[model samples]
Target: MKQTDFVEVKQMQVKCVLCDQIEDIDDDALQAKRLRNRKLNMYLCTPCNERIAKNTKKRHKSGNFHLFKEKKDTNDYL
Candidate 1:
């Protein structure tokens, strides 16, 4: 397998807090969630994922949102 494919396989281990099921998430999705947590100490529950999305959207709309800096690109040299 290609190196990119290997990295993709490695990061698909995020589990749902409510159901205890591992989600088939790509690296981008996982990074987005982690970025949200870094900005706000928000944790995700399966039942509350939508709520979290709505709340963050509201916070953004109200100008009370926390924002994380973009991650450094891992493909710099290549």
Candidate 2:
């Protein structure tokens, strides 16, 4: 990529974990900071987030939205 003249501020490049879309976000944003600090933090685009929210709402209204929790192994240490 060629360096443009209006390249003063730095942009944080992030990829959506689900959609794999590359986007540029403000480096000073809170989300960017969280992503940089946490390894498990995932970044989702606006459309993907909206779609998940809509589907979750629909499932909740249907009374079949069950959040399955992971089974933790019990420790045997005395």
TM-score of each prediction? 0.32, 0.58
For TM-score, the strongest prediction is 2
Clashing pairs in 2: none
Write candidate 1's Cα lDDT for 1-78 as tens digits. 888766633344555665675655555675546744676343355566887789888888656322322223334434
Query: Can you write out model 2's per-residue Cα lDDT over 1-78, one digit (the tens) per residue?
Result: 557866767789989988999989999888898998995399988799899899988987665423322112223332
Backbone collision tally, model 2: 0
Whole-model lDDT per candidate? 0.56, 0.78
lDDT of 1: 0.56
Worst 10 residues of 2 by lDDT: 69-78
- The TM-score, computed over Cα atoms with residue i paired to residue i, of candidate 1 is 0.32
